[model samples]
Target: MEQLLDEFRSTMDIPWSIWSARLVGTVVLCGLIGFEREVDKRQAGIRTHILVGLASALYCIVMQHLVVSDEFATDRVRTDPIRVVEAVTQGVAFLAAGLVVFHQGNVRGLKTGATMWLSAAIGLACGLGLWGLAVTTTIIAIVIIVLFRKIEQKAGTHVPGHKNAGEKEA
Candidate 1:
């Protein structure tokens, strides 16, 4: 009884303001990338991106609470935070794999899948209170998706048999 109370209290020690900031950051940063995808008419859009980002952020927050609560145990079980990160990556990879498709000798969704993976990473960073990292990464991803595509088209690099890009997987 007392043990449960102590664990609960420990977890609740985190400030609500901090929690709100992380969650909001995850949404905004991930949304920017998602909006890019929406503009491109990709399958995954703003809602999907926001959902992934929010879920990832929630998982990280849960992990944080668990870690804090673990401290109140009589037998403090040391946890490797890396494990939580690995778990998140594995889950995100599963989602990313779903976004990819191969058809007509022209692979599609690879970029979208990669974007999903990036969204997860950004969400994780936001959840972990790395606002700058999340923001910078979002900006870089937007540039790669938006500006790079323009550059590729202008250079005719994205066309099949173009010099810049190799043949997609058969």
Candidate 2:
């Protein structure tokens, strides 16, 4: 068991400590957001959110290492950070799309999909060492999910696409 762990650690060019910190942060942030979704009976909840965030963070870490390598610095190999961001965004977009459902002319799960996307973004931020950004975004997400729900309920405002009376039947 010790040898297996050592081999795995050696395979990672990054220090295991760094990986541990980023992954844990990703899990925590995503888990908190996902807990809210779970409470609301979302199909994709804590486990899904944690996995998505972990994957994004791992991708970012690998890309970061490649971009900073000496080969790129010496050979003038152009590295565009936006490309990495775009790739992650596209991957997350696919997952988000899967979360949405259109049934009988009504669209549902937009909030769940959006929150999943946010989880990926927070993971990316953590991977890039933007700890402050990830924390702030998580707090804001929780606030929106919890507080806004109360406000919506008290005001009796039907969400725009959620079976609103003015919406036409498909």
Candidate 3:
């Protein structure tokens, strides 16, 4: 059993230390962003955000390891990691589409959808060992999602497009 575990770890090509760090960091980042969404009662809150981030990070690690393997190395082999980014973006678009609703002329969950996309990007950064970037981006995203909403609401009164609450536009 121990041998099998060791072999599996080796196949993943991540040192246990680094893997543990990545896991913790990804979870923290996801939770931080998710907490903001949860406070706003968003649909894709804690679990959804964490799952997306962790899965994307894992996928990135696997893809990178495979591309760098000895057997796959060729004299002219070209492996562009951007392909992974593109694929993840395309796939996440489908997830985002599902969050959109056509009823009542109200579009909800758009921020949640965007949060998922950013979570995935953070995960990719974590997978590539860019801890500083991932952490900074997560903090910035949280601030934007939480703090900016309040600012926008307060400033809405003075903004031209936003009329007083009880007043209808002419």
Candidate 4:
């Protein structure tokens, strides 16, 4: 059993500690962003966001490892990380489409859909070993979702369409 474990660990080609740290950090960052979405009561809230982010990060890590291995074995390996980003963006678009609702002549969930897109980007950053950027971006996203929301509400009241029906229009 120990031999199998050792072999498996060695085959990964990355330090176990670093891999674990990256995984945990990615998960936590995803959860933080998800939590903010949950507070907003969006359709794709905590679990959905976290799952998407984690899966994106995992896919990136696996692709990177495969690319590196192919290079070491002198095989024809194309190292195009942007492909992963493109794929993730496409997939997130599908997810975002589901979150959109057209009713009462109003469009809802657009911001939530955008948030989902951003979350996937953060996951990609984490997957590409950009832990600091991912963490920083996640923090910024949280602030935008939480703090900026209040400011937007207050500011929106002054906008023509957002005012009460009695308000005069220019």
Candidate 5:
């Protein structure tokens, strides 16, 4: 009974405006990155990215509340928020790794994997209420995903362990 009540209170710990802002901001930022992936027809598209972002943010938000609760408030608990981040990182990395593949001496889905990783990062930043960092990171990611890809294609740029843009697969 007390545990149930604690969960309810944790949900309400943060004000509506702040909570909504963090979630919505995460959606918009992650959405942009996901949109690019979708346009590229990547396996991990908008929905995957958005969900990843929200999950990451929720982890931090919930941790913030629990950290202040009596269960964790005791000095003996010695709570450090970095653990939450590490947990999120490992979780996201597992998901992102699935999108990556190695076949025939060429790696694929590298960009999608990196994007998924970044989505979690953006989510964490938004959840921590670092809107500026989240927004800036999102913009930079978009530029790299969109503009840089175009440049690489047009220039036939070479990437390690992969053929140049114009090279035919063996």
Candidate 6:
């Protein structure tokens, strides 16, 4: 058991504490955003947001590690951070697409899809150790969801299964 534990520990280059912080922070921030969705009964609620945020954070961490490894290599290897971020964005876009549905001339789940995208961003921020950015983003997201919901209700702008206030289902 000692040897097994040693071998497992040897596989990780970064400290466990750093990884734990990133993962836990991502989960907590994303979970808060997810809670708003849960209250509103959105399809992609807590679990989905948490999973997306966690996975995105893991991806960011791996990408950062890969860049650092390349930086210290004997043979120089180019590492483009933009490409890594673009890949992450594409992945999150795919996940968000899964939540969207078009039916009977109406689109559904737009807000939920946007929420998932925001969750990914929050995860990336946490992974990069930008605690302030992550926290601020989460708070802004909650405000947008809650405040906009109220505004929509008062303005009658956010109609279910409809494009706009004046658009009727066909």
Top TM-score prediction, candidate number = 5
Better of 4 and 6 by TM-score: 6
Which tens-of-lDDT digit does each residue in 1-170 have in candidate 1? 99999877763546889989999999999899999888777788888888888888888887888777745454657756777778888988898898676665656778777888888889899888988899999998898787888897798665422212455545
Q: TM-scores of all models?
A: 0.82, 0.81, 0.80, 0.79, 0.84, 0.82
What stretches of model 3 exceed 4 Å from their correct place?
1-12, 75-78, 153-170
Model 4 misses residue 125 by how many Å? 0.9
lDDT of 6 by residue, 69-168 (tens): 7345546677676776677789989989987888766678888899999999999888878899999989988988889889987997766433544776
Residue 20, candidate 6: alpha-carbon lDDT: 85
Better candidate number, 5 or 6, judged by TM-score: 5
> How would you encode candidate 5's per-residue C-alpha lDDT over 75-116 as one tens digit per residue?
677878999999989998998888788866667888888999
Collision pairs in model 3: none
**Whose lDDT is higher: candidate 1's or candidate 6's?**
6
Expressed as tens digits, the lDDT of each residue in 13-101 for candidate 3 is 67768876886788889878877778666778888888888877887887778687876688777778888888877777789779866
CA displacement after TM-score superposition, residue 130 of candidate 2 (Å)? 0.5
The lDDT of model 6 is 0.83
Q: Which stretches of candidate 4 lie above 4 Å from their native place?
A: 1-10, 71-79, 155-170
Tens-place lDDT per residue, model 4, 1-170, is 99999876666666567666666777888888778778766667778877888878877887777777744556454577678888999999899888777755756677778888887888888877898899899888888777777786677632222323235666
**Winner on lDDT (3 vs 6):** 6
Query: How good is model 5 by TM-score?
Result: 0.84
Q: In model 1, state the lDDT of residue 66.
A: 73
Q: Residue 55 deviation, candidate 2, in Å?
A: 0.8
Off by over 4 Å in 1: 1-11, 70-76, 157-170
Q: How high is the lDDT of residue 133 in model 4?
A: 95
Full-model lDDT, candidate 1: 0.80
Which ranges of candidate 6 are over 4 A from the true structure? 1-6, 11-13, 70-72, 158-170
Model 6 residue 68 CA deviation (Å) reads 2.4
- After TM-score superposition, the amount by which residue 65's alpha carbon in candidate 6 deviates from its true location, in angstroms, is 2.1
